[model samples]
Target: MKNIIYFFAAALSMLTVKAQDFQGVATYESKTSMEDMKKFSGNNKEITPEMQKMIEERLKPMFEKTFTLTFDRTASTYEEEEKLGAPGDQMAQGFKMMGSLFGGGGKHYKNVKAKTMLQEKDIFGKEFLVSDSLPSIKWVMGSESKKIGNYTCYKATAVVPVDKSNMMNYRPKKGAEEELKKKSEDEMKKTNFMDMVEMPTERTITAWYTPEIPVNQGPANYWGLPGLILEVSDDKTVLLCSKVVLNPKEKSEIKAPKKGEKVTQAEFAEIMAKKMQEMQEMGGGPGSGRRRFGG
Candidate 1:
């Protein structure tokens, strides 16, 4: 009986050591579907087949992207990977010509143990770091399971609240603000263009996580899970982990990004909203000299 007890204690210690040695880097492929964008163009009369092809081709780099998520026991950081442009292709050449016009995304850091999150974003030429509480998602665990890569993952579903005003930025300048002050709120919504109707909806999120990892971290702002999220998707975008290296030889530095204009999420949204409104007033939309910033 003493020998049996000693053997069981030794096995438990080994298991704890193995769990402690777990640090992983996951490579994810992200894709955003463009089928829904077609619905927005009500009788696109000016859209020729040639124009459509060019638009579709340009959308590739935006929709199809690769990112790396470095995670440990309690936190994770997600950032997009830079890629080399292809050579000797007309479509690629076209994209390269407009390279400086787009691509300014943010870095996301989530610390589940601390219940904190930090987002570093770039607006035009300015950088801002928005810190907020970890998103509170009420996830309903599901019995369905599937194998993604080497991990057996279970499904979880949630309905996330969408704030439309927070998603768009349209802050008006002094002159526009003064002129716009005379208009009522109803008139503001009627004349205000740019399709801000996506607000006030419940977006569904479906996630698949594996308990084998036992870390409540995932790419971007996703968290509050019992294990590592292998795949997650909403209607427009999907993040799928293509490769995960557990106990990596080199562990990445996990720290919060603190170099930017400090602002809360709500404050940042207000700033963006005012900026967007001003830009639109100055004839800024669909090739109006104002470049579109990537998220």
Candidate 2:
């Protein structure tokens, strides 16, 4: 009898949330910590604490971003707010620009009903509309619960591939890749892949969701939860929902980005790989590379 009562309570909760239209917007504040980079690259070259501080300040705009997630029952669009002007030295400024090109800040659209996604990407000024199937996450539900703002939240976790969260942005030559594999275990005995290489094959993502607001929507490429995800943390970053407005006076224009040349995720990866290889050949990355993006 107790179990039956609990089941009906859950059913009632779900039905209540579903009865009310959940068309609104959630604003998220994303912060990227550079402490990891500082520790790794601190001794890579001659650098001082003040210098590190300068780099951190320069990366402020990119590290601290505001993302708006406009969502409804099964369709949602997430995009970063326009950035303000940045202040830094020439080198810092250059690094910031490089981050914009190689790293994040893109418009992402997810449709749970259709199981599809349309993402807009910018690689070195060239735009690409990446259209593909939504990557599924095998989320393991947890018994933990917490309160986020006015909503009571529960926990969930997932072991996701690194690429599902972000791109590598590094592409070695065909021969170089083979050469790396050819290295004997004895030869690499002294070298540490953890401290030296970017091993982003897998990552564990932890998310906090609010069952009170039962909507399968979240920021970025995350969704399909029984409720809206209010906070998510991974290896490199944490995105928290700072504000949520339900049934806003003005209806949001939730539309997938239609600009840029259409390409699949794999297709975009190949293009980026080719471009990186060429750039490295000319004079880039750790070694060197060529530039000229399809020029």
Which number leads on lDDT? Answer: 2
In candidate 1 the C-alpha lDDT for residue 9 amounts to: 57
What is the Cα-based lDDT of residue 107 in candidate 2? 81
lDDT of each: 0.69, 0.71
Taking the tens digit of each residue's C-alpha lDDT, what string does model 1 give over 1-295? Answer: 9668746655653364358656688899988777644433322445677877778776688668898888888777888886666676655644433322232256778888889988777665567788888879999999999989867789999988653333321222335434444556566544433542234456889999987666788887788888789899987779999998877777778777887888887787677667656656764442342344432
- In model 1, state the lDDT of residue 109: 85
Q: What does candidate 2 score on TM?
A: 0.78
Q: Write the per-residue lDDT of candidate 2 for residues 1-295, one digit (tens) a residue.
A: 9668756666765775565465768999998776655544454334578887776776677678889999888899998897646465555545434543435647889999999999888665677899999879899999999878877789999987665324332222335434445456564444343223343567789999987678888988888788899999986689999998877888877787898999997787677666655654554452222223466
Off by over 4 Å in 2: 1-21, 86-96, 99-102, 164-195, 286-292
Runs with alpha carbons beyond 4 Å of true place in candidate 1: 1-21, 84-104, 163-197, 286-295
Clash number for candidate 1: 13
Report the error of model 2 at residue 110, Å: 0.7
